[model samples]
Target: MKHPKDPSAPGTMRVLDKQPTLQRRSFLRGGGLGAIGITVIPVASLAASKDVAARQSFRHLGAATGRTLVRMARDIYPHDKLADTFYVEAVAPYDAASAKDKGVKKLLADGVKDLDQRARQRCGVPYAEVKTEDERVALLKDIEATPFFKKVQGDLVTGLYNNKKLWPLFGYEGSAWEKGGYVNRGFDDIDWL
Candidate 1:
């Protein structure tokens, strides 16, 4: 007796294939592994838009790199009042740039890998998992002279600070020039100035 041949190959798509995309929320929820992560991953600036625990992804950067960038952005800005979501948003532009340019992709990818490597050398864990603030800051300072660090600094200045939703954290009252300048607004309210 002989076995019959299969109609379609395993894992290949057929006209009526029932496979659902892993990107869908149903996949994560269906899995009973509890939380599928190492540390609490940062959500994108769209913090107000979705379930943050589901995780934020990047087209150019890996999950670990995204997490590292979140830490780097926070270290640079040092905004204890703000959440990691804002730092995630600030670092998101690097991923977008990498998606657009292969050179940028290589630069950022290599830069982040190096940064992570430095962290591992200092401690035993990756950059995002490093416990001490001074250690992380010192690690960043090592790369402060590189183009990658400069690009991150320049982009983050706008990406982190220019966010209207985050302005209140920095005490910026949303561009006083648009409201006829600050001299007549906040300053005027300070009577004894």
Candidate 2:
């Protein structure tokens, strides 16, 4: 029962021997789940802990900071037809940047605090908790010229609309290269004239 690679063990199984083989897709999927605060448990324990994944919470940024980023992304790219998930995805780069750069992290933290302070001064509440849209808009107007706002806005412009998952929803067929360069796949379908 000893692993051939190990010389010390005679009858005991190695740690790798007890683990199941992992596929690349499954591994990436697990990582994605982890990023969103979902725990990937063994399939054997899945039935018993179906609710565990639902209860787990993961936040790349602080809860308040994340909320503010989401709201800001939505404002910058206002699409009433799009779901909140789109806005969340749009702000993911900011979260990632904050994680990698100390300056970015400080910028986000300070920006969120400043926004909350402005909201408190104007509406007696935190920015994320502000009830009136007009008040939130006014608060955003005050900070729109700041470097943090401009950075997030610049990131949102490309990150929000350039996502491949959103292309189909917006009637974008996404690069006809795979279909023979769209030579016969509606490339010349336009006949409005």
Candidate 3:
């Protein structure tokens, strides 16, 4: 289309620019093929699985015992971003130890029973069934002096803190030794502080 008054050129683009180029730009422009619009979908989501149920098995501890330990682990750590599966994974070490050591098995079983009794007395439900976090925490506080409480707390520290996979969730980028230490890196780059 050309204007009646101005007859500079009919086409909007210049002839040299509009014309197809040679091998220099051919590879970049994909010759004549152009870029295909390909949408990629993965077989499964890579993000943390929230709804995935943890399959727990314990030789010495009962099903209720494992469930109670999971709840207790969360009550202690209390990370909102973390899932129940993580708590399950954390408390699983206790179950493994209990299988090998009868003393550990007894300690867990008796402690759980005692805590459940306290919950029943206070809220008319077992410890695992306790509705309020405040009340459950109160129950844990009451037993804080006990060996079982100390043992479980120690187990959780190992299970949670030592995990490399959980490092990213807590904003930890692992030890700085491998990356030539945090001094050279953005050691003070933290904006939240």
Candidate RMSDs in order: 22.1, 21.3, 19.0
What's the true lDDT of residue 33 in model 2? 18
The candidate maximizing TM-score is 3
Summarize candidate 1's per-residue lDDT along 49-160 as a digit string, tens digits: 3422126687677777778778776666564445666667778777788888999888788888999899899988888889987788788878888887877766777887
Model 2, 47-86: lDDT tens digits are 5543332232225567668777777665555543455665
How many collisions per candidate? 0, 0, 0
Model 3: runs farther than 4 Å from truth?
1-54
Model 3: lowest-lDDT 10 consecutive positions: 29-38
**What ranking of all candidate models by TM-score puts the best one first?**
3, 1, 2
lDDT of 3 by residue, 81-188 (tens): 466666777887777788788998999999999999999999999988899888987888889888988888777777876777766666668889998999988898
Against the reference, the lDDT scores of all candidates come to 0.68, 0.64, 0.70
Estimate the TM-score of every prediction: 0.68, 0.61, 0.70
